[model samples]
Target: MSGSVAFADTTFIRYPRPAAKVDSHLDYVNELLTEALAFSPRKYQLLPSKATMQQGRAVHEMKNGTGEVDLLWSMSTDEREKNLIAIKIPIDKGLLGWRTPFVISENRQMFKAIKTLRDIENYSAGQELDWPDVKILENNGLKVEKANSYEALFSMLEAGRFDYFPRSVMEIWKEQEVHASKNLIISQDIALHYPAAYYFFVAPAKRQFAEDLTNGLEILIRNGQFERLFLKYHQSSIQKAGLKQRTVLELQNPFLNPANMPLSRTELWFKP
Candidate 1:
């Protein structure tokens, strides 16, 4: 019998949850892995478990011989890369790096005067306590508050506890729609730019799995399947973000490790 490759079901990564199906992100990863493994001599069964992002990270870190999970997909950071093997291919084509703010509709005017990173530093931002982006924002001289729950961050923003909540361009629209009644709106005037990429991570000992994933992604890219898959799920979100109209406030990624940089792979990144 072929061994099974297990992964986490990161529910928060996408929306429109079907009553009895995996989210689009997990589905796509499974499809890509299947296609990749088809070319190799090894055939493996897939096992997906319902778990939060933090829970998945914990299981991956344990790296016990039990094989609870074979992989995880998350934002790449220097520390994570050192602890886990990262397949450096950016799954979203760098879309996650382009961010817009979620502000109380009444406070929308607060960001109007912000034209540069320096100007934006004066405002406070909210992020999940464990997110690597917290350090990235602070490194750029911006003040950030922490929240333990994803949903709680919206409430914090609504209460004016933080000046703004920065979310990815592809994520803000759906979030804004869901929380519209909360009196929050995506800021239309500016988009924050940083070097961020999400990658598939596996235990350090799972080098073969990491190699298989990278090979599969490269083949998908070369055959154009990757682009097709990306557009199918993200095109609508990207179009709705109206990136061209927003002023781009660029910031440096302090957590980027030199070994994990993917800038030379232009075809693998989305340009907008």
Candidate 2:
């Protein structure tokens, strides 16, 4: 006869909700979280916070332990890792650092002219003020046009307030669809490359939960579940992004510690 086994207590992991509508559907990150937690030994319930927060505010709350949000996902940086318990696994497999720009059709030739990092500097880039990518661009000596909100960035690009808006390959298609009425097109002639890792960062004082997630992710990796799930959601996007056809201009992420990058596990990244 079989009997139901109960755990001591279920851990409710509440991640934050964006202050503004960022996407119609959740990214692959959320799905990865659901799948990973399902494999954990202890029972867990993943939920979203009722409070709306911006990227910077959410990180601040996580750092200070002032919020009920248990964890959040973002590109890892030295500062964030120091303040939060980072899982160190590249959940997005470093795809967030591979940027493809969206340009108004008339300005497509402008991007086509960007053959080098210096050429890229001639045109300003649009990014949220809180995003670590902004600092990366500034570190690389590029001009940036900052926006206060996610939706505003798109509108700014259309209004000619910014020359180009570079988005991750995984994000470009969906964003383009959302703003289909706009004349923006993903620039296939150029891509900006930088080595970065997207990590699930546990809030301050949540070390135990962090370890559990890390372990579950490792379990997924060892059994090849991680790779399979990653490919299922991202392979088609990768192929359609036409990354290989673009002239790759590499950039540096000064805020990230090179030593901290789990590059040895080459399976955790997209090769192209």
Candidate 3:
């Protein structure tokens, strides 16, 4: 409220999928956005969009300034950064890239014999068609089965369409529980690691607005609110991951651009 203005922009954010409720991912992002704008020099009224769309459609809407989605949170890729105004500072603190590969509990033995990247090359992985993970997997010489939707990926995995599915550490445990009946199990033998980030994006014309959000987040970081929020939502997931015990198969993330990342900020990232 430092600057007095007669009018303020009411920013529109995408609604969480499934309408009546939001998952922890969206819930955390929503609260983070609110915290960033809470004491900003400029006032912004945050409101969810009237309806929801898939990530692919949402990306198009954001790029075209379609008004249905004013802002989106997703894994940052080279293409997304180039087309939309990215906040640069990763909201997920680069945790999204740390993946856990899961498979049907009955078929978990598929990965048991694998010990190295070349050993797992013949096994196919499942990923959303539009996800940046697809390119990352392929870049590392893995075959990927593309799913059109997130929900379909698990069913496909059960059907033996793909050898396994790699999901982020923050997401796999919860999803495994949600689809408990599917008998999917996280591969205890090996996990996947990559350098990736998740970020907030805006339309190309909203560079100043993006900068405002970035500065606001920086303010939260300086005051310790940012890490607090992150831990509140993700700390348990980290502990449950037990990453130190797993044989992590590290992979290269060709999409991560060091220049666009706040690599200098050590406190912002999590190391396992």
Clashes of each: 0, 0, 0
TM-scores for all predictions: 0.83, 0.93, 0.89
For this target, which candidate reaches the highest lDDT against the unseen true structure?
A: 2
Q: Please, what are the lDDT tens digits per residue for candidate 1 over residues 101-213? A: 99989987887777788888778999988777898899999999999867788899999899999998766766776676798888888889899888877766667666766
Q: If both were scored by TM-score, which would come out higher, candidate 2 or candidate 3? A: 2
Model 1, residue pairs in steric clash: none
Q: Higher lDDT: candidate 1 or 3?
A: 3
lDDT (CA) per prediction = 0.74, 0.84, 0.80
Q: What stretches of model 1 exceed 4 Å from their correct place?
A: 1-31, 34-40, 49-66
Clashing pairs in 2: none
Model 3 pairs whose backbones collide? none
Global CA lDDT of candidate 1, please? Answer: 0.74
Name the TM-score of candidate 1.
Answer: 0.83
